[model samples]
Target: MRELHEHTTTTAADALGEAEVAVLPTGSVEQHGPALPLGTDLFAAAGVATRVDRADAIVLPGVPVGVSDHHRQFHGTLSTTEETFADYVADIVESVAAHGVRKVVVVNGHGGNTNALRRAARRLRADDVAFTVPWHWWDNLDDLIDARLDTSLGHADAVETSAMLHLTELVQEDLLADAEAGAADSWGREVPGGADVGFDTADFSDSGAVGHPTDGTAEIGAELVAEAVDDLNALVDWLAAQRFEDLRPAPHR
Candidate 1:
């Protein structure tokens, strides 16, 4: 694995100079019901990123906290303001850009950071810092989920539990029974017109879980991870071969 944390100064410098893109895993330290770990998002992000087969990309150390204020009602949930998180992410990308890395991919695991990451990507593009994109692992792995699991993205649910299972020992396996019992099945309650109302997890789920945790299995988790890695590998290859000048906006003649 081409990981920044494991590289020496000289080797890192050389690698950075030649790297086509740097992959930065960003996640949250938030509640994952009774069974999953607080670091579930981070673990998923880092695990997928590190497993990607990219010789020209460097997988940077993960940002283990994010905009998770919605989950703050749960214990062990740490969060940063959207502004703070976006700025921090922007700075990280800027730092890497300064090191001559023209392309950067923020492999994100937290849904809360979506808006913030989009804003950051826009800012980076406006400033011409680099071609930066925030890739949510769950968002990109819908097909895999459809094939391997019965549901989509859900907090501390089957998908997440399966990922934590793949991490080995990160999940509280003993508590899964309780977690499954408390799973909420949907994101939130919808109004008469089908519009979903926004609220904290405590307002809906008694156990802070939003899906079926019992549906998760380590075998499925491994498949999901492999699917993610393959997708990322293809993305990195495409990004590496693109010409920035051709992709940049053209001025009016």
Candidate 2:
């Protein structure tokens, strides 16, 4: 892994020069429920980022906190304002661009960080500082997840629990049943008029989980990670082959 932090100034200068793309992992350090660790998202993002075994890409240190105010009712949840998160991400990309590596892939692991990542990517592209693409680890895996767990994605649920199981040893296996028992059937609450009423995780989920946690297994988690890694590598290859100038905004018509 060409991890930026592992390299000294001289080595990094050489590595950066040879690197065609940079990979930045971003995630939230928030409550995942009793069964899962608070660093689940960060670990997932960083795990996938480091697994990209390509010499053309340089992995940046991960950002461990994100826009997670909705989960604040739960313990150990840390959050930053959307604006702050966006600016912070943009700043990092800008700095990377200063090194002449302008193509970047942001491997994201939290749903709440979506807007901020998008905002940051857009700003970077608009400023011509970098060409950034934000990617979720679970992207393009709906079929595999559905086949294995028969459910959609949820916070600290089977999908995420499986990922944690595959990637780390921090899962509290004994608490999986309790987490599922208190989990909400779905993500949010809605009224008769199609108005969504659920504002916070506390409003809908009793355990801060949204799906069946007990259904998660290490086997499925491994599959998820493998597929994600394959997708990431393909993306990196595509990015590496492109000229940076061609990825930037087109001249106004």
Candidate 3:
């Protein structure tokens, strides 16, 4: 197949009689921090998807808008209701699978998008299309993510900022300052900046970061990204190894 996330080209692999995995980058156009773009979620996911495509997948256009209702407090943020987002994901997966492609992978960014991934996964499986999605920050690379933090960093913390810095050099100085100041008062929890600052979004973090951004560095961010890609490849390889018998659904009986 041509690739997971690339422009769909039917004949690309028609002669092979095997479908290649199609990867969709799921992300959001929401507030990240004072320094980053409103497209951080999409950008981050696309970054990984790009790498995955080069390595083994056919990368598709990224779904830039997502269910980011929690981040609606920020001006540039765009969100769809969960139902709507779920519908969009299903439609895309179904459309691609309709073309004789069955393996679909969604390289996701944005913590807010995980719920949609789960809902979409269950839905895709029900429809008989094999689908898998990385749960943004936690899929397959827990060690790398945790290595960059001391405690659980809250929003806009060291890990995120560092990743942004490493990935795109898109860090914002003023916002980082704001995030740090708020972290001190909010008890080190700040979910993503540019949106509203409130108790609901504030509950999980004190200064806005549940973990430590103090230790985040570009080197760590790059390493984490690499590890994430490796984990994703491993998943693809494992899936490819399964045969019809290997995937047999368990009998309810």
Candidate 4:
């Protein structure tokens, strides 16, 4: 499939009429853990989004920056106000809509961006704009993640690190080997005598890798990719069949 990054104006235009959907990867750059790069969310979303089998639909460049106000307490964090972020995203959809795309899929990776996108999508719809829905990877893969992961080295924990390992072998994980099964607890308590310290990724281990790196391998990441691609493709098919009002009776029905 041709990627948006590789297409000329004409090719891009042509794909619009030919393709049923347009994909926009939405991600963020902030602290994950010492073991993972700040761009982990961005790359993970990219890895999965690019793998979608949308024949004529080309993958566009992802939104690399996002609202990171929560992570602003950490170093090297760049965030934008929610309003600014929403405007930026709205502009993206509007710019792409100029093409023949009647449907759009914003593949969101960060947890923070979901509500904002929801609000924006609703507003756009209320204005009679044409578009598809925002699909959050975390929400979509909840069933998969729940079956595989427990509440342990979370946030910058096991699942995320494993994904990075699978997508790029060069990812930093020198400290992942020290993962502590349960770092922080949901009750706002800490695991007693855990190897980790304080931080979103802390409590799991000193360097912020949660659970066990021993449990993580490139193979698992590959499995996640397979599952994700399969499910997302199904979602794309469903999106293609949707109407602005599935609320009304269909002619066949």
Best by TM-score: 2
Q: Encode model 2's per-residue lDDT on 1-253: one tens digit a residue.
A: 7699999999999999999999999999998989999999999999889999877999999999999999999999999999999999999999988999999999999999999999999989988899999999899889999999999898999999999999999999999998988899998899999998999999999899999999999899999999999999999999999998899889999
Q: Write the per-residue lDDT of candidate 1 for residues 34-128, one digit (tens) a residue.
A: 88889899999999898875568989889999999888898999999999999999998999888888788899999999999999988988788
Tens-place lDDT per residue, model 3, 151-207, is 443456665666676788677655665555545323323457645445434444333
Model 1 earns a TM-score of: 0.95
TM agreement with the true structure for every prediction: 0.95, 0.98, 0.79, 0.81
Please identify model 4 stretches exceeding 4 Å from their true place: 150-153, 177-214, 244-253
Off by over 4 Å in 3: 1-19, 53-56, 184-199, 202-215, 244-248
Worst 10 residues of 2 by lDDT: 47-56
User: On a 0 to 100 scale, what is the lDDT of residue 25 in model 3?
Assistant: 82
Models sorted by lDDT, best on top: 2, 1, 4, 3
TM-score: which is higher, 1 or 3? Answer: 1
- Pairs of residues clashing in candidate 2: none
Task: State the number of backbone clashes in model 1.
Answer: 0
- Which parts of model 2 have CA positions greater than 4 angstroms off? none
Clashing residue pair totals per candidate (backbone < 3 A): 0, 0, 42, 2
User: Could you tell me which residue pairs clash in candidate 4?
Assistant: 153-210, 196-205
Model 3, residue 248: C-alpha shift (Å)? 5.9
For lDDT, candidate 1 versus 3, the one ahead is 1
- lDDT of candidates 1 onward, in order: 0.87, 0.93, 0.63, 0.67
Winner on lDDT between 1 and 2 is 2
On the 0 to 100 scale, the lDDT of residue 227 in model 3 is 76
